[model samples]
Target: MRWFGFGFNAFGQIYVHDKLIKGECSDAVKQVKVISPTELASHVDRSDCCLKTDGQIRASWSRRASLHLGGDSCVCLGGFGAVIASESCGISMKETPGCKDAFISELYLTLAFPDRIESWDLQKKEKTPSWSMEIKTESSGPPLNLPLVPGGYIATKPPFYRPLSPQLKAKSLALSAEHAILLSASGAVYTWGLGSHGQLGHGDLTSEEQPRAVEALWGMPMSCVATGGWHSVCISDGGDLYVWGWNESGQLGLPSRGLRKAPQQQSSQQAATGDLYTWGWGDYGQLGHQTLISSDEPQLVEFFREQQMRVVDVVCGAWNTFAAVVKEEVACS
Candidate 1:
């Protein structure tokens, strides 16, 4: 159960202390914490918080608001100031949605939410966090991290794949500042969350709070999907690319500041899809076009075809567009 801390030095969040009284970690030391895992376990909840980087205060186990520990509480779990342990006979964790947006390292399981994240130790040969008692908290934030675990690689766990929708198989996912989109295995597209710019592809400007299938592209199996700062893009199986949402930076691969006329809503056709299209926020040349003109519609990038090349894949970051392609022989060759 060794914990290795390596990252930027802007913060002292990874510092560990040897003096353990069952409380907060001290950042007075400049070295990484290792050699022992018990002290780390007792203070793991404190390690995950970035807000308390000063590290001067020690957490008391006696606080009524804190989790009650029992003799079996050799293992501890904490996140976002809330903690529940095997010794805490009052807590049960079965009802909450399991942790997503997290990473499982060799010795630690880091569950990251939007603002903060916490880590739980995986006890391979030690005491496991008992799940018999359900854990409850006063906070309304979504509780994450399910199934107290033993030390092992995340890949070795018993199959944990659960379907979001029994009928729809998700093929790909993309997220913007406040919205997200999902593509189904069968090529049906679903978009939800802040739809002010028509990023949801529902044909009008409105936000969606839940997953809604994009009716405009029904039956057209999408091979690829991508998103940037405020826009979204998807490629159909027929080698055509579609763009939507905020185009302030030409992210949609268009030439001006207006949305392209969406084609008449037609059912999808079964065709191979491949191509790179970008729109929205092209001030950084993210659209991949040679110029810096912003666009509101889908435009084909001619650089690849003009040079006898074929695109394998394309990805857009906050301000840049990257593509992977296979080069084709030109007539001169």
Candidate 2:
């Protein structure tokens, strides 16, 4: 069986693929199914299952595949007699009363016989609610690379390609500007551009051209790394949380108003010490401190003192900081 996938990337390229070919193919093609919105609504119910006249609901065949049906795009499965709701090419079933008689953008239709290559041909049906079907075949080449944007990029390891060095494998598998953080398997942390207030943890007040390793963090072995708009937080293997970059709001949890142009050592004093520290500007409560002071050096913040909750994740936005902690579940007898 051939497995196909499609989606849009940060570079504005539409990625569509059929995973049965070797290496990369010189030409790739997509088959789409179309149907009228009125007819679609009658056949499929709000739950996305097909409804029989007797009210028996059957499972939808296109549930596993990604599809879009309304809003900016729409898709219908003509042969399967079903319509799907989607966004950005992924499939979801949402009831859209406005889309009652609208057009379907695209749909994935599986061919019955793969051995026989069938060409697409447009046909006109002699029926009311008149409509025409236009089918054409085209060749596709290798997938193209897209340009970097402010939000960054998301990617998965290609099945055919292997990293030349072990180091590359531990690198970022995917990244985005808002809330994506990556920690390589090797324990090193590399951050990309957009460190307005020292969020990149370079110990400097500049944005980086490409991915750069956090110097002071070298050899320490990072367990996790989190990125914010202008600041960054990281957790070490020893269960300590270190923060750096813009601290205008006490987000860095330190006292003073100097940006930490570098990574400061956070104390792992006790497991209950909170291990949280901050550096840089502090205008708002972002630093989680009493006064609005900034510091170039690392200062400790003692929030979460009683719980001593081990922070598993930390994320920063333009001016907000958030941390995720492990929650204990009560045992049921």
Candidate 3:
């Protein structure tokens, strides 16, 4: 398997062979911005054991984490070309065998276990989690779940929890910088919060104080939904993809005449045949187009296709992108 990365690398966040000293070199000499797709070393420890993403790839502003080997191991990378072992951060997948996933951020590393999600603060010396949220394992739970709020969805302070809107049983939830989206069990899509960029998919740029069903997508039976900085995308049951919201950089895969770029906003997809495509903000080469030119339309990332590599999965970061790829097997008659 191989991995490819591109975009802002000022801190070596996307992985570079040499260690980067912030102030030691000029901006041009630093080679901080990668304007094309480049191969990233598979082994973070420089060892024979290559990093694997058997499960998922999660990213933060300046770091990336890959969970592999049935979640038994987690490999983390930062801008300085250092690999942080899970054990070093008091995260032992072996001890907590139930750990199924993880989330990374600028200040926290969260682990999702069977019953709860624990968050550890990177700035603190202690390895204990500063906070955690309980995850209901069973399909049945308190009827009233979280409700959409101004900046995000909220559950009342713990110990004295208050559940609101019991009727809305969301099967999946996604949160952007300023809005929230939910997919109900019936496959209906609901959105709320900031709508200045029309991310709510309500056909208007009006903010919603409460969860509002996206009428445009009514009866479509969306199977999956995702939100970016200020845009939204969802896949219908029939495999049709729907997109809305800010298209400044053409993140929505729609025609955009204006060049009002929205940094860190982009979209990507892996085709059924294993091809990968990216579009939107490319100022930092996040689009993997080999050029620092933003595209309003989806462009095929030919590197993988040219090398006979099939992209199995893809994940986008704040300013970069990562793809999990494998060599395609050839048949001899």
Candidate 4:
């Protein structure tokens, strides 16, 4: 399997080894933006260490970290030539290999282990974790008490602790810098929080103080949902991908015009053709379109297709995107 990254490389967050700008000396080029999909090296500095395909890749505004697939260690790369490997810290990731099991913020890296949750303050540069807590688990089948994932329960940050309606059972949850999205067990999608850019998918740019159902997708049974800085996307059981919200960077995969307050028009919707696609926020080339031009509509990242590789999963950082792909096997007739 191979990993491809596109978007902001100002801090080397996307892992491109080539010079970002030509003619300008390497020392003179401060930031690099890849307008197209670029292959990423297994190691941040193009070192010999190999990264496993199943590892977790997490991105923040100016930093990127990847956890080894075995949950043994993680490598972090940051702006200004900052490279840190957590292997020496002796922090065990044995039970936190899942991508969702770890989270990275502007100043903190939190890992959800089977027995506890540990948080490290990146800015502090402390060898010991700033704080940690043991998780209580019931002895039995399926590990009764697992780390908090997007599900029936809701976890809030700071002053925003809105609860879901009593009757609504959430199957998954996604949160952005301003809004939140919930996928109910029944396949109904609900949203709340900041909606200035219409990330809530309520057909209006009104911030919802409480969780509200997205009437536009009322009868559509969605299987998965995701939210970006100021945009939202969901996948239908039938394999259709719907997108909405801020189009300034063409993250919605539509013709870039301006701010959009609703879901894309029918033609703008993308069908899940088993190919990796991206749009919007390409100022940093996070959309993987190969050109600095931000796409207002979903565009197939042809790099993978050209290489006969099938993308298995994708993760978005505040300013970058990483896709895990494997070689497609051709059946001989």
> What lDDT does the true structure give each of the candidates?
0.43, 0.36, 0.67, 0.64
Model 4, runs deviating above 4 Å: 16-31, 42-49, 71-100, 137-167, 258-273
- Cα miss at 50, model 1 (Å)? 30
lDDT at 246, model 3 = 88
Candidate 1: tens digits of C-alpha lDDT, residues 44-80 = 4443222121111111111111111222111223321
Superposition TM-score, candidate 4 onto the true structure: 0.76
RMSD of each: 16.7, 18.8, 5.9, 5.6
Least well predicted 10-residue stretch by lDDT in candidate 2? 1-10
Q: Per-residue CA lDDT of candidate 2, range 46-94, in tens? A: 4332222212110112222222323322222222222222222322223
Local accuracy of candidate 4 as per-residue lDDT tens digits, 1-333: 677777777756665344521333366344467666666674355342245666657667766666664545444444323433333233333323442355666666666565665666656645666666655554632332111332233232322223456577666778776677888779999888899998888888899978899999999999988888898999999999988888777777776657354556444445445588676666666777666655566667777777788888788888778888888887999
Global Cα lDDT for candidate 1: 0.43
User: Once superposed on the true structure, which residue ranges of model 3 sit more than 4 Å away at CA?
Assistant: 21-29, 46-50, 53-55, 69-71, 75-77, 80-98, 134-136, 139-166, 259-272
Cα deviation at 320, candidate 1, in Å, is 1.8
Clashes of 3: 0
Model 1 CA deviation exceeding 4 Å by range: 1-163, 258-280, 287-311, 325-333
Best by TM-score: 3
| Number of clashing pairs per prediction, in order | 27, 35, 0, 15
